[model samples]
Target: MLSRTYSRRVDRVQAAVDALELPPAVYRTCPFEPRELVETGLRQWLRCCGAAMLDRQVIGMPSFAVDEAWHGLILCTERYAAFCRRAYGRFLHHHPQGGELAGSARRAGSMAEQLRRTAVAWSFVARPGEECVLWDLDVRVGVPEPWGAGTRP
Candidate 1:
């Protein structure tokens, strides 16, 4: 079972993912499953999602882990990144401290770097025999836009 705080984080991430309207894709490679099987499974999943699925080519590798119960997924998109920035700014507003904006700027830079590195990355928790729960979902915007660059609105 996930802690309350973790659960809240998952809820927030899920809300963000939902807002993106990118069809969900489950990527997992079991120890017992062959690579071919994993690929086939992912393809099948995407097919099931139909038009809702984001272009596989654009999404790149959907699975970020193998044999691990927990996983992390980072969806990189300009809109999503803006959403994260707004969300983070709101968070900072509610909980403020000196030099917080500087720290946030540094983190934003790091996030941008990661976004440039991958189309989508995954970071979540999935315990065996239980549903996978998101612990941290990082959004990397492809191109840095001027909108939502500063503090919260």
Candidate 2:
């Protein structure tokens, strides 16, 4: 069952994501078709992150397009910081794939393992009728060369 706080944070995160406008340059860098679907996927992932904030879990990015969308959001420092405060009460840090801390236990997982955790986090926070496309968002959105190959749905 979802705690009231977690539910509220998820709602706020979704709203923040909805309000964001990813610039065209972002798409130019990580091209994908059916922009709406990719955007929706990104929103859902962020909501999952918000929900999992207290758990201190690592939610991996399973799609190149969604990752790009996140990159765009992060570039908007003020808006992203404000949105993070509203959604999770703290800034959600992004650790690039190869930049894990030297001995940090939290960063000690393979990409596949991280993606599996992401799926599990989504299971806990997904809305009643919500369906996650993140597992295969790259291929679904026709990313030229999808990033995630071993991700489990």
Candidate 3:
């Protein structure tokens, strides 16, 4: 069973999805089982939410991390949302565990002070699914190296 916080987050994400005004058919074909779909969606949703809180801009054109990092220093909610939707459509492609994704977001949020001082920001990109990457102002530092390779998620 999902925790209360997780469940609430899921509800919010679902609400956001509904607000997108997309047809039901878009969500109906999720490749995962119903339960798994919800789990994956929750993670992707949180990732999107996290990215939305950062300073970045959404781009209509998709590009590699290197290019994206150089394009802007601000985060983009539109890009994040579209990425989440695409990840859901792809059945969570390279989905990480829901707990890990959520926890990472929480950790990132808690590091506001560090981020401001280090000239760093975190964001999520679809890459066809959710992937967490760190940016040093305008340079792609790299993905949160396995969550503990000399850095916290």
Candidate 4:
């Protein structure tokens, strides 16, 4: 899942910022099928979120993940879904699974947490080098038959 936010500087004589909450992770609703997790899909998802932050494309309706961190998603004036595809694709190339998130979690020589729930969102803060701090958004999966928690993260 991812959280997309934008602060626009509006000024006639001053500046202001606007923040919008995005949807849960793109793959949150997709079932993991209890296979100890897969590599390709999750890694691709993370890469997309990171790219969205770097690209500055995320907007309203950021997605989320199990841990409640916000993954950055880009917003395109053209359409939101289109943006998702672009971001996801970029992630696939940057951090291929079975090589990173999926493969490394089981080993000690690696980094990157293995995520359980997919609901997610994101945001970014400036830092040195080409890397911005990566975030995984938080999303809620409604209770199976009826009620669930209404707490805010």
Worst 10 residues of 3 by lDDT: 57-66
lDDT of candidate 4 vs native? 0.28
lDDT of 4 by residue, 24-61 (tens): 34234443322112222233344434434444333221
Error of 4 at 90 (Å): 3.1
RMSD of candidates 1 onward, in order = 16.2, 2.3, 14.8, 13.6
- What's each prediction's TM-score? 0.25, 0.83, 0.21, 0.21
Would you list the clashing residue pairs of candidate 3? 55-74, 55-75, 56-74, 56-75, 57-74
Which residue runs of candidate 1 sit more than 4 Å off their true CA positions?
22-77, 86-153
Model 3 regions more than 4 Å off: 1-22, 35-50, 57-152
> How high is the lDDT of residue 109 in model 3?
43
Better of 1 and 2 by TM-score: 2
Which one wins on lDDT?
2
List residue ranges in candidate 4 displaced over 4 A: 1-48, 51-85, 88-102, 107-121, 125-141, 145-153
lDDT of each: 0.28, 0.76, 0.33, 0.28
Residues 1-153 of candidate 1: C-alpha lDDT, one tens digit per residue: 547764555445444434543222222312323433433323322222221121121112223221111121122244434544432222111112233455554443443343232222222322235321111111121112221123111
The alpha-carbon root-mean-square deviation between model 1 and the true structure, to one decimal in Å, is 16.2
- State the TM-score for model 4: 0.21
Of 3 and 4, the candidate ranking higher by lDDT: 3
Residue 5 displacement (Å), model 1: 1.2
